[model samples]
Target: KINKGGQLSMKESGEKDKNECHGGDSRFMAMTLKRGRKKKALEYLLKKEESTVKAMVDLKKKYA
Candidate 1:
């Protein structure tokens, strides 16, 4: 945490700052996926979600 003067506290060292803009190691981007690869992954996820929703709808129709 920072003080009102916008400076880190004594217990908060500069190395503890986790902001990616400040050159922190981001675990989220650690995969190193390419742009096209990311697009394909997202499309696959969307298709899976769509199929799950469709199956749920069909199950509801069958029971309700």
Candidate 2:
């Protein structure tokens, strides 16, 4: 799925009942910067950080 800017969604699903999402946040930022979209990249980075934090919290809860 593409977002509003025609960017590919980072969300994905796996065969083994696992949801596999790419770490495309940084890559997306890189691409945006290359295209001279610094502000957009920064916004994406913020959202990416939130997602990372949520993932970390989930992992900790599962393992701890």
Candidates in order, TM-scores: namely 0.25, 0.37
Expressed as tens digits, the lDDT of each residue in 1-64 for candidate 2 is 5443234444545232122233333334445566766576556555554655354334334433
Candidate 1, residues 9-41: lDDT per residue as tens digits? 333345453333342222212222323345543
Of candidate 2, the 10-residue stretch with the lowest lDDT total is: 14-23
Q: How far is candidate 1 from the true structure (C-alpha RMSD, Å)?
A: 16.3
lDDT of each: 0.35, 0.45
Best-fitting candidate, measured by TM-score? 2
* Regions of model 2 farther than 4 Å from truth: 1-23, 50-64
Superposed on all Cα atoms, the candidates' RMSDs to the truth, in angstroms, are: 16.3, 12.1
Cα-based lDDT at residue 63, candidate 2: 34
